[model samples]
Target: MDTRNITYFIAVFEHLHFTRAAELLGISQPTLSQQIRLLEAEVGMPLFDRIGKKVVATEAGRLLHQYGMKMLQAEMDAKNAIKELRSENRGTIRLAVLPSDLDFQLVPLFVDFKTRYPETSLQAFSTIFVREEVLAHKVDLGIGLSGSLDKRLVQVPLGSEPYELFVHSASELAKRQAITLEELTQHALVMYPKGYLGRDLVDNVCREQGFELNTVMEVGSASSLLQLVEAGIGATIQPKELLKQHPEWSHIVSIPIADPAPIRHLELTYYADRFISKAQQQLSESLIEFFKSRGVGEDLELRG
Candidate 1:
């Protein structure tokens, strides 16, 4: 029953001599014999056969040795796993990020992360609803477009850029290098649903500039919105970074919106209610550093 006694039994069983086993265990021979007797009594079986100075393990002793060894190994394994986690030498980080982050932000950092922490790994889910995912504890950290967040959440700004409008390459609007708020409003516009990232920024900017924010269609998914824009269904306003990432959108051409730009910020957000794991914190540092190295995000601060 007692693990210490089991250890003593193992030592005695292996040595087959009480004096030698006690010497190996750093205990007296009398103490070892008394503990072995107590262990046998608790198990209701004789663990050893004593014939004068000769000692050998009984059936019960051999069985206990097998099971006891297993228990000890399991405990060692648990301790080792916890130690690795505490040391940040190993663990998986559950993270969520917008689809746009995969291209310019997360991908490059992931390469460096893997190289630095080879024993660790990541579970990533990409979507437009990064905040919701983090709030629900579905992911440990999230990187997405910034907006008002719950008080329980903390956000670290990574980078930001002014909003831009993308149109079909064949559209007459694409002939110009840039567009104005008034000109973009003259045509039908594709937009994200209410509460979606960049939705408020575009709408507010349109109102501030005295242009009506006309929405010809509304969608929840970023991919679908981009597809509609590429097909020339309607023009759409999105962060400049998204446009930079997907140059393969051959059907799409973007025009910059001039001065006093309506901007969207990208950020790393986590729940302030929970402890930030080493892997998650490491990732945030890597992201901030990644952006800084590229001469972007200079004004951004690494959030505590």
Candidate 2:
């Protein structure tokens, strides 16, 4: 029932290896094992079952893990609340963003936030699984494409933008103001790999329309994908906001997609019960304002 022991247990459960967990925790393997054993004895049940070299959590272990995370989160929230009472702008905010042009686009907003709260430590990284990261309490907040409803999360609608065909100014398609989804299939295209959220959004729409794009290249890096378009290699389908953010990429023109344009809905998500520090609250407001300034989420309702 010791919080320290519960911490050790969670570490071991996450890594599923004593030596690895011990190394991460900066403790010896024997010491970590002893802590786990003590925890198991205190709980009066086997927490893990060892099968050869593999370690698997038992039914009890899984149940403890579910509540253990909340307990630790609550403890941390209490500490953060106390700290905020002393100084409103002195805490760390961990944010996860979609691994695409959106990350680069938000750089200016991040810079402004840092300037306003110099004492606040902001750690932002790009990930494809923004929803999962936020749900697991791995990050204080996340910004990504709208996902399925989860009661544990507070999702604020950032805005929705239409997917447009991006091509080099010199490309033949650039002369057209808009292109139909069916016509887009006739041209060579470069896109994100299969599992990416943005790519999947467009793909799903294509499937619904009874067609698939003629993608000639699949590049995971957002910069590289745009570079391919700049090189006149192939067209790409992306949110129009992406090109609007990069004035340096003036050579690239985003033409609207007609006949039911694919739209990407963006949302800022965080745990509903998690304490929102002043720094986190301000940053969230900044994000909402930033998107509004860009003329993206005008019609979307603000929800938390």
Clashing pairs in 2: none
**Per-residue accuracy of model 1 over 29-100 as CA lDDT, tens digit each:** 999999999998999999899999799889998898767765654554466557766685667678897765
Best by TM-score: 2
lDDT of 2 by residue, 8-113 (tens): 9999999999999999999999999998898889889999999999999999999999999998899899999998998755799999998774455899888889
Q: How accurate locally is residue 240 in candidate 1, as Cα lDDT from 0 to 100?
A: 74
Local distance difference test, per candidate? 0.78, 0.88
Off by over 4 Å in 2: 299-304
Model 1 — which ten-residue stretch has the worst lDDT?
72-81
> Per model, how many backbone clashes are there?
0, 0
Candidate 2: residue 169 lDDT (0-100)? 96
RMSD of each: 17.0, 1.4
